[model samples]
Target chain A: MSDIKARVSFLGKSANILIWLLLIGACAFVVTPLLFMFSASFMPAIDIMKLPYPWVSDHIHRQNYWNGLRGPDGSFVFLRNTLNSLIVALAVTITTVLLSSLSGYGLAKFRFKGRNAVFMLIMATMMIPFETIMIPLYMVSMKMGLQDSYAGLIVPFLTNAFGVFLMRQFLLTFPDEVLDAARIDGASEPRIFTHIVLPNSGPAIATLAILTFRSQWDNLLWPLLVVQSDEMKTIPLYITKFMAETHSDEGIMMAVAAMASLPMFILFFTMSKYFISTEGLHSTIKG
Target chain B: MQYNKRFSMEQKKAVWGWIFVAPSLLFFLVFSFYPIFNAIYMSFFKKNLLSLKPPEFVGWGNYVYLFHSKTFWQSVSNTAVFTIGTFIPLVVFSLMLAVFIVSRPRFQKFFQMALYSPAALSSVVAALIWLLIFDPRGLANQTLNTLMRTSGVNYHWLSSSSMLRLSTIIVYFWKYVGYFTVVFVAGIGGIPDYLHEAALIDGADSWKDFWHITFPLLKPTTLLVSVMVMIQCLKTFSTQYLFSTSGAPTRPIDVITLSIYNTAIKDHNIGRASAMSVLLFLVMLILTWLQLRIAKTEDVTYN
Candidate 1:
């Protein structure tokens, strides 16, 4: 009996070791491409393309960065593309925070007719794919004279359903007595929101800001449809060559990709906890 | 008199609610609801893009043309194949990965952070990484050749039909498989520890315990992850769009999003694109409805 018990313990230990090995192996698999891209961005054009697989550059070369920024034919500037993206992302984030918090506060605090219907409508919008609405939104932008302008790129996405949903779900748990106390002290609703509610909802606001910024920063499709000029082109457009004048060179591709992804890596690494927090995210449909 | 005082307070509350919600409602009306309705309306007309001519009324003509068009059919089939191929393996592997992370408590955060690092990458960047791996004599092929002890395997990752499809699937899976893993881990983490202890006390082994306790309890997370993954896969455009334009065969990778993009922007056909959008809209509506229905029937298993 003692011998059998000892054998079982040995088996359990081996299984534990195997699980750890598998876990590390999967982590490497997940992280390798990003690391490879970062490393490959430093490699020269010849080393990037030639065989024997240069995993690391023999000598660091920064020309790829210059080549990428100089555009494919050396006829354009990549800074403009990045600037366009930054402007759109920042606009969307600030607007989303303001609009979503106000509306989410309304949905959570007020006892009003049609409140349920309004909330349901906003939640339902999350399910609708953008492809369904692209053409009509495109037409609307053109008719409103927003095409090829910053307004066209940023206006449609300024406020999103997900932000409202996130904000509302979070504010639902907020104490009602605090607002009542503010009201009794003669604070108006807007004043109450600006002073009392906004200060308390810091975590939700941060979550929304990070999420909004990350998504808008990575936005591709809508911008692809609206922008027409070389000056208005975004990062994905450069790599995909939708607005560019020449095909992407192999080294330039790595460089542009690395540049495009750097801001997000910083954001995700710093806000890793918020990005994967599962409370309001996974349990959206609460019982 | 008493009724008047109570009713006035309720009215004041109602007015305040509308005041706060007005901006968001107006934004949605113009951007979300109105555009959806307009997309439906535009599907029935023949509107020439880049022309001042008024749209001609041709009810079902665009839809009919789409039904007969070989390119549209190919795109629909490609989308279906991409959705099914990518989603199943992704959902299963991510769930297993989540379970593994949950079992090992010591390095849970470490593995979670490592696995989820790729979720932040844009699809364009994700595809660019794989583009290297799929090159003729690139590292992926080289590694496989070395493993099999063969030289110059010469598989066409981008050029061939089947291989091109597989390459796109790999790119997507690499980017998002970690994301869903984190979601599942969160779901599994929410399960209380007492149940596992009870199972162990009742002589249940690790595999049997997971099958009985963890898997059943994860229904909500599984539903949420599957729905999100399905919609995301259906709406995938960047990888497919970037792949074809960057020299892969456009036909095999022509997803519906890419098709809509080309029709509207490239060929200047708004009506045809609107027709396709309406169909996609209907499909998403059904998927979402299915998720809601399934979620409602589960009846709060934990409580």
Candidate 2:
């Protein structure tokens, strides 16, 4: 009995070691390409293409960033594109948070006729892929003279059904007695929302805001259709253009990719807890 | 007087509800509902994107043309190949990765953060990074050559038909595997601890306990992940688009969305593009409905 127990303990120890090894390997697999991108961003183009490809640069070359940002004619096209992406993403995020919270509150708390029908309508649209409707949407944008402008990008995606769903699921569990007390104290519905609902909805708002911002920042298909001019191009388009013009220079392409991904990385690192939260994941999948 | 006052209060609440939901409803009506209906309507008309003339009605012409077109069929097959090749491996490996992460409580957060790093990248950025890796004299070939003890043997990651398809799959898998793993981690976390304890008390080992208890309890999450993966794979556009534009052959990787993009933007064939989109929408709808039906039957509610 003593010998068998010793063998069992030894087997468990080996299994634990194997698990750690597997975890490290998986992490490395997920991270290596990113490491390569960062390393390549500072290397010369030739070094990047050399056999036994250079994992690190001998010297940190800042020239690639300068060249990548300043276009062939020295116009800061990449910077302008980054600004456009920021503006669109911020506008969409702010409006989506405010509007989604309002709708989510109303749908979750209040009793109203046609509420379910309205919700069903919105949820039905979530099933329809944006590609299926792009041609018509493009036509609509053209008719409204919204093509080639920020309004064209910002207006169409102000709020999505998924945000409302997330917010509603969150607000459903909110205590109604607080709102009732506020109402009994002569507070209007809007006042109750601004003062009571918004303050208490930190997690849901943060989750929705981050998701909205990331989606807008990374949006490619709709922007590709709406923005025609070089001036209105967003980061994705800018990167594509840079890749095309500087096909031979892997360093410059990597530089552009690194710069474009910086904001998302920062956002993810800061609010990652919300991203992997069981509540958020549960609501997202429960639908 | 009391009845009238209560009636007015209920009416006031209902009015406020409408006031709150109005803006989003209007936005969706114009942006989502209108476009979906309009796409279906426009599929019957022959319209040139650049032409100022009125659209000429040609009911079912575009659909018939698509059904017979070899390029459309090729795109269909390519999409099927991409979806099948990617989603199965994605579901399997991400689940495995999730199990590995969950098994080790100490490293769960660290492992999740590391795996989910790539999902934060935009599809364009993801593809751009992979493009460098897939270059002839890049990391992909170097690693393979070193592993196999071969010198300067090019794998043709971008040029060959099968490898090109595989390259796109690799990028997508690398980007999303962590995301779904995180989702799976959340799913597995939802399983109650008492069940595991009971299994252990019954002399069931970890493997048997997982197969009999955790896997069955995780049915809803698995269905959700599979459907989400399927839908996302069907809608894959940017990677294939970027690869084709970067001089890789378009024929092998031209999925439906990319084909729709080319038809609309390159060829200026609005009617044809609308028809293709409608067909794609039907596929998504059918898949979503199928999932819902299966979910209804297989739902495992905890008492």
Candidate 3:
């Protein structure tokens, strides 16, 4: 019996090691594309395709990075576009978080007529694919003279259903008595919302802001349809334009792509803890 | 008198609740709900952008044409393959990864961080990076060639039509497995440890415990993950656009979302595209409803 037990333990250890190896292998496979992209960005134009390994070259073509940052005429077009995306993302995040929190607070804390109906309506909107409405939205944007403008890009996404849903859910965790106490202290509803509620709901707001910012930054299709000029292009649109115009220049294209991803990569690596913890908290809060 | 006053207060509370939620409701109606209805309306009309003529009512003509079109049918099959191909592996891999991570708390944070990193990369960026890696002389092909040299195994991983579909599925899995793993981790973490402890005391092995306890408990999460995956697959476009070569191949990789993009943006056939959108929406709705039903039945059985 002891011999058999020992064999079983040995088998389990080997199996666990194998599983760990497989897991690490999968993680490496996932990161390989990103690594290759980074490597390719530093390769010379002539060496882009000459490869068993793209990064096996003797010298790194650092000029590709400079050219990527500068435009065809040596202007800082890429930096300008990145700035535009950041601005739009930041503006959208702020607007969305504020609106969502206010609305979420109302829904969670207040008892009102037609409240369930309104909430259900907002929930149903989540099912409607944005693609189905793109054309009409385009026409509307044109009619409203908002095309080619940041306001057009930011305004439409400001009142996000996901944000409202997330906020409402978070607000549920707040004690009702606390709000009642504030009310009895003659704290006005708006004041309670601005001071007590907003101050306490930092984590939810942070999650919403991060999600909204990332999405808007990466938004491709809508921006493609709306932004006509190269000046108005966001980073995704900028990379796409670079691809279309310079299909032959793999080094430059890869360089631009790397630049587009750098900010998001930094943000994600630094703020990953929030990403893991926020989802469950939001779900339970929403429930 | 006090009871009557409290009832009035309750009514007042209900009124204020609606007032707070009104802006969101209005925004949804005008922007979301209205556009969907508008798409349905647009589907019934025949109007070309260049002609600028008022829409001529076409009734079910658009739908009938869509059903009859060869490309539409091909796209439908492609969508099915894509959906099934990506979802099965994604679900299995995520669950396994979650279980592995959950078992080892020491490396849990690191694994979770690494897995969720891909999601932070924009889809466009991900597509661009994968495009480079999947190129003929790219890392994937180069690695395969090296293996072929050593092992005498030669295969076209992305050149053939079916192989291309498989490649796309692999890319999809790599991108999404982390997101779903996180979700599953949340679900698995929520399962009480006492249950696992009890099973251990009863002489149940790890595999047996997982089958008898963990898998059954993760049903709701499975349902949620499946639904999200299906919707995501339906919306998939940028990766396909960036990866596939232009023009038809022996095995087509055209999915429904790509078809809509082609018709609307490339072909400039807006009416037909809107019709396609309507059909896609209906299909998604039916599938979602079916999934909900399956989830409900599973819940009943488990209970």
Candidate 3 per-residue lDDT over residues A140-255, each given as its tens digit: 78779888999778767877777898889789999999988997797867788888999999988888888888888878878877898888888888777676667677788788
Docking class of 2: medium
Q: What is the C-alpha lDDT of each candidate?
A: 0.81, 0.85, 0.76
Error of 3 at A71 (Å): 2.8
Off by over 4 Å in 2: A1-18, A278-287, B1-7, B291-301
All candidates: TM-score? 0.93, 0.95, 0.90
For model 2, how does the per-residue alpha-carbon lDDT over B30-53 read when each residue is reduced to its tens digit? 888888888888899999999999
Considering lDDT, where higher is better, how would the candidates rank from best to worst? 2, 1, 3
Clashing pairs in 2: none
lDDT of 3 by residue, B117-141 (tens): 7888887778777766666666777
Alpha carbon lDDT at A274, candidate 1: 81
Best by TM-score: 2
Question: What does candidate 3 score on TM?
Answer: 0.90
lDDT of 1 by residue, A95-142 (tens): 999999999999998989899999988877866667799999998899
Q: Of the candidates shown, which would achieve the greatest DockQ relative to the real structure?
A: 2
Candidate 1: list runs displaced more than 4 Å: A1-14, A72-76, A242-248, A279-287, B1-7, B294-301
Per-residue error (Å), model 2, residue B9: 1.1
TM-score of chain A of each: 0.88, 0.91, 0.90
Q: For model 3 chain B, where is the 10-residue window of minimal lDDT?
A: B294-303
